[model samples]
Target: MLMNILSIGSQGGWTVAIVGYSIVFLALVCLVIVFMNLPKLLQLNLRKKLVKEGKPCAEVEDLNIEGNVNAAIAMALHMHFNQLHDEESNIITIKKVTKNYSPWSSKIYGVMNQPR
Candidate 1:
């Protein structure tokens, strides 16, 4: 007896539907990830642009004026961590402001803003 070769099992509609939905679900997941990370991507792109424009140590104000996102972030970090004010009035202002701020308030804000 010779075996027939033309007859074969094929997938049903339900199986095809499930596979199609799964692919769509995966694509949506990827899109969500990209959307969430879009800000960081733009920031990086802006930084490269600032560098190309020969701008260094760009601050948030500068970035804003230049319409560059990366420079704003770089400037913010610089002011927060590296920049210093030498004026006596500024020192007094910081001291007086902190003196009036409650310790609990400081603790809460500090904890909330701490780097991960």
Candidate 2:
């Protein structure tokens, strides 16, 4: 049965190829359509949720330039103070490490010796 199927002549091969390609292209087109509309659908759902929550559908604009200026000034002051500070004398140091490996310490060699 496998040999019979594999022995499909030139015309049968072309027919199978065309059908397979058509199915793949049709699936791709369907996916493209769904993806293209996905963002719009999500936005509509968001708008609906916002409306249900009594929030405005329109986006709010940030109008406070003074707040931004105050934040910038605060950051600058913090950086200036940090730069003027001195480092502490206390420090941490790694002293020593020792490693000892023995054949009896590991079971990997025993497992490797087992027959598959």
Candidate 3:
């Protein structure tokens, strides 16, 4: 069926077009799936639900402090790259994350930097 569409406008160009479109379409689908699962992938949804239910009072930073050192390291990168830089909007957007587990609290200092 899709092959027919690609075959529509040109003479054998359809094969190339079809292949290109198929690759693009597949890439897009993968992207959508990743985007949809991003929240869960980051455990953001779980954190939000827990917070709303009052079952968990701990923020991510707290968890970072308590959890494995590797997780803490990962979260550190997560914080640096994921933090919002828009001072005006004041919106912190985490890519691939759906929920806000912990509100930003005291300043976070990277390993080499002095505490803020």
Residue 81 displacement (Å), model 2: 33
Candidate 2 lDDT, 1-116, residue by residue in tens: 97777677864786788899999999999999999898668678877887899988774223224558989989999998998766676898898877689888787778568776
- Model 3 has an lDDT value of 0.72
Q: Model 1: which residue pairs collide?
A: 59-75
Candidate 1 residue runs with Cα over 4 Å from true position: 1-11, 57-116
Reference-based lDDT, each prediction:
0.69, 0.78, 0.72
Candidate 3, residues 4-99, lDDT tens digits: the string is 776687776867878999999999999999988875556776687778888764664454333487888898998988667634866788788566
Question: Against the true structure, what is each candidate's TM-score?
Answer: 0.38, 0.43, 0.32
lDDT, candidate 3, residue 85? 69
| Candidate 2's TM-score | 0.43
Report residue 106 deviation for candidate 1 (angstroms). 87
lDDT of 1 at 113: 83
Q: Compared with the true structure, what per-residue lDDT tens digits does model 1 show for residues 1-116?
A: 12232233453655777899999999999999999898667778888887888887364235444437768978899887754664355443334433575677676667558666
Consecutive 10-residue window with the lowest summed lDDT within model 2: 58-67
Clash totals for all models, in order? 1, 0, 0
Residue pairs with clashing backbones, model 2: none
